[model samples]
Target chain A: MSEINSSKTVSIISRQAPYGSNRAHQSLDIALAAAVFEQAVNYIFMGDGVYQLLGNQNATSIQSKTLVNALETLDLYGIESIFIDSQSLRERNLTPKDLALNASIVSRGEIAKIVRASDSVFNL
Target chain B: MSTLHTVSKAPSFRLLETCLSIIQAGDAVLFIEDGVYHCQQSTELLRNSEVKFYCLREDLIARGLIDRKLDTIETVNTQGFVDLCVQHDGIVNWF
Candidate 1:
């Protein structure tokens, strides 16, 4: 997959809340897959997607897989370009301490640029 | 790179609000389905000059918002919607 010097940049914008639907999980999988292939991946959490990063998300009671467990493998997969929308966090009254992962808090304007720069974008 | 964002929900859901936050200058937003309701509101995004605003003509007519829509909003038909998509680099749909 890394035969070429330059790989296409892919941006995965996950905007759905965890536990409610499969979108959040699917987006994460896509990001990891892109990273595995040596593609430049940008994982952006916006709108309700930011909720997927909240700490203490235990889904055992709901009989579902814990998202945090999968999130823990992101570093191992080399997908480090994680971004959280600042406006979404402020609107939800949440901060970095409330989340389980370390991500760059970026303004929406900056996010727009990220989407524009990406060779391909997947909005889930 | 300019983007064409499409909002399909009403203002009450805040989808448009979130979408507006990410819009940049030279970008365009198209209101479709229930999103036409946004045209009737007095939201500040409608007054924004940096980005352009467009709404589906059929959706607005279906919702009886023809006379109520803001003059700042440009009404477009299905063909125009496809044209907008082709004119932009990307399209993000806000449900």
Candidate 2:
């Protein structure tokens, strides 16, 4: 009972790619903190957010920090429920093999279940 | 259980006004990115209520509006930004 009371599930929705704005990094920061606190974390890549999962990103040309390294660390934090939007991936012509990290390709219906199960949702 | 509302757009955007309307009495509002340009306009939101107001220090310096901030709008760094997020049960990013 104590364990159940102490842990809250947090869903962090990332909706943008790296380099274009600061949001991608900011959302990661929140997820990192939530993981450290031992909360169950779900990092959902939605809409443009799926772009963040692309592998071998080098922002050096753009003079921005590459999130490729951080994206790889999601598994280490016990945040195993990373979900990428299926529609977004198909629209962008990307496949699971294109992403740096492995993620569940979820349809909108599956995504809704994830959201409904969360105690809190962070929109970034 | 209050919400930490983050606004990253300028006052001209409907986002800022929409945030103001939905914010409850105890909610905290933080101005980030171009949202710092609207710090003065936000003063009206805090005039009669207990809603907390903060602006990201780095964003304010970048925009060159440091000296003109209203007395009520406190400035916070990135760590403070994280603390605010933790203090609230929920977060609403009004982009």
For this target, which candidate reaches the highest DockQ against the unseen true structure?
A: 1
lDDT comparing candidate 1 with the true structure: 0.89
In candidate 1, which residue pairs clash? none
Write down the TM-score for model 2: 0.57
List model 1 lDDT by residue over A36-95, tens digit each.
889999999988899999999899999999997798679899999999999889989999
Q: Residue A120, candidate 2: how far off, in angstroms?
A: 0.9
Best by lDDT: 1
lDDT of each: 0.89, 0.80
True contacts kept of each: 0.48, 0.19
User: Candidate 1, residues B13-88: lDDT per residue as tens digits?
Assistant: 8887777787788989999999999999777768888889999999999999999998889999999999999999
Question: How would you encode candidate 2's per-residue C-alpha lDDT over B1-68 as one tens digit per residue?
Answer: 57788889887664555455545557788999998987755445456456788999999888888887
Chain A only, candidate 2, TM-score: 0.92
Model 1 docking category: acceptable
